[model samples]
Target: MKRAWSPGAVYVEFSSDPRDWPSVGVALLVLVGMGAALVLSFLVFDERRFGCMSGIEIGKTLVQVALRQLAQLASKNDEQLHREREELALQWSAELKAAVPQAVAYLESRVDDLDARIAELSSDPQLRRVYTNFNFEAHREAIDERRRMLAHAAAGLINPEITVERKARVERTLRALDPADILMLHGANLVPGRMRGESLLGTPSGGDDNPGRMRADLLLGTPSGDVLASSGCVRMQVSGGGAGQGVWTEVFITQLGLDVLTALRTYTQNRKLSFVVPGREYKETDRTEEAARKILAALPGLGDLVSWSTRRSSQVERLYDRPRPTRGFAVLRFRMCQWQDWKLRLENLIPIYDKAEVNLVVSAEVQARSRDAKREVFVAQFNGPHDLLRYPADDCEALWT
Candidate 1:
């Protein structure tokens, strides 16, 4: 029953120098090695199967290392993708939202897509065939349904928590602006204000009736569109009208137009063609030069009655009267050259008239150089005290503004 050892079944090898050994001893050693191999073979079936188990352990270790490295790389990639998504989201919410047109377009496109879907649903004949569909116009019926839904949903907000900061910010920004800068203030404070008769027999007049006064802002607007204020209240006066009555009419002059019509002094009461409105705040258009006035006169509103002087073509030697600003009234005098028919220039010319008095412009011909240029003289004349002119006549001054 004992198993026999066979050299063919199992074997061992020796590589040491066997040539130096005794022949019998070597043969005996070889026989013993063979016997040991045969005994080992009887115990185990195959040596290759034992080596295979060790090889499996080494392969498992290599696989675990490779898997760990792959897992780490995948985690890094996931983190990078998350960061990229976050950055993109922030950019969309921040800088992209600031673009007014693009955001509006996106909202409109979404609404339009919804509209298309709603349209498609309403026209679905198959749906109508299946359901107990009543006879209804597609567009009209769809609109009615949408309206009903909108009425209900209107109470519920789509974007209920949008806060806006407009009112206070607008006020703060307006407060920051400097409209009345001193750099814009022009002219010296020449005359300030004067005291006059507090009308005794009047209807509780609470206004100043004084003569010498000027405004702080001497602003001027020119036909050239220049705005400047150069001088303060310049005073003027006028007298002689319906005297000796229980209430005699008296002429008083002050720069109430300037807003500083308090107790002020006289500028130069002597004699001057141009009178200052006292403050530099008068409109720039009011002080436009004669040349610019001519250019504007060709235009609609600009062509109405304006102040100008005239000379007679009959006698160049005769002196012509320039527009003179008096204390209570402004005056313009034009000469009649041949006492001829009224010219077109005279027709278009406006005669100043006040609400209190009605006056007529007796037109005649006069040869005079234009203030713009001392060029060839033309003839036209209008002379009449303006305050005497009344009503619709008074409205003529409006052509200048």
Candidate 2:
């Protein structure tokens, strides 16, 4: 057999011999059966792979199905997320709506108070300066009732009496103090005191030089019952005792302290709190004053110490050295001989010495008029034989004279 290829067909040539014919006939039959088998195989395989659809059509269908399923899954997931988000928003909205009105009302009442204050200030021409000077923004968040009332009362004071600068300072000071610090002034006396020192070289107890004992008086009495020597409310004096020969400390309320206390007392009276009015009750049982008198009586002094309750007392003129006059506490004076005896007696007076030191004042320098200045001022205790005087003492001033 021979074969040639045309554009689309195959040509075959066979030998004319009968032997060749029979072989050729058998080969032809085999070729036809093989071609038929191949056709059948193609049809069966097409049915199995694509289920009667063409390859391209089947591929398109698969892509559509995948896209449709993905879209459905995304839509379901989005709906689930949306439902959860909506539920949370509804809960939060309900809670906020229920609570917001009460918060708004409370804030509105505060605004109304501010408005009333503004109206009151504007009505008085004299208070216009205070209105202008007051820093509302700085004090906007101030919530303490006592402090707020104090500030209002302080502002209501006539203007010329309190200069613009001083008023501004007082306002700032008012806000700076803790409520307890302000309240503590109720126990402190207005008897302006000082802290002073003297040379202990010539004194009898000077030889026993212990620095700790020298300044022990500073810790004797604190207003807050703490070790603080001076709060900003009180003035502080320099404690000078080169290498601890002798040191004195005293406590006195500041002008600002006095003003704040007075204002709070005056304005906050009807309210919940009030300041203690210092007089008969405060002076009568005052621990420091009582202790001083007990200590003085026990001491082996020169003569009987005179206490003049009234200016017209019969013994007033006899005292060539006048005793100091203070506003809130009693005054006692001890002479040089008296100081010596007092020192000797202090060791034996265990009751007064060992008692808790409350209202026992330290000292500081202040304006002369602000304090009681006199000769023979009350001396609490003389550390040595020399002299223990308050700050701003005269030269060689006797301890108590």
- Reference-based lDDT, each prediction: 0.31, 0.41
lDDT for residue 271 in candidate 1, whole number 0-100: 17
Give stretches of model 1 more than 4 Å off: 1-177, 182-328, 332-357, 360-364, 368-375, 379-401
Candidate 1 structure quality by residue, lDDT tens digits, 85-189: 665445433432333233233223324353454346447554333212111111122233322222211111111111112211212222221222112221222
Q: Quickly count the clashes in candidate 2.
A: 10
Which candidate has the highest TM-score of all? 2
User: RMSD to the native, candidate 2?
Assistant: 30.1
For candidate 2, write residues 1-401 as lDDT tens digits.
66698999998788887768877998887775565555445543545667778756765555565558669999999999888666644543443344334333322332335445445645766455544434342234344443344444444343223344555555566555544455455445322222245322333333322122222332234344241233355654545467755655444456766655544443333333234422112334334544544544444322232221111222121211212232323223332222333344444543443452423232211122225654332233322111111211211122222
Q: Quick one: best lDDT, which candidate?
A: 2
How many collisions per candidate?
Answer: 41, 10
Question: Residue 50: error of model 1 in Å?
Answer: 60
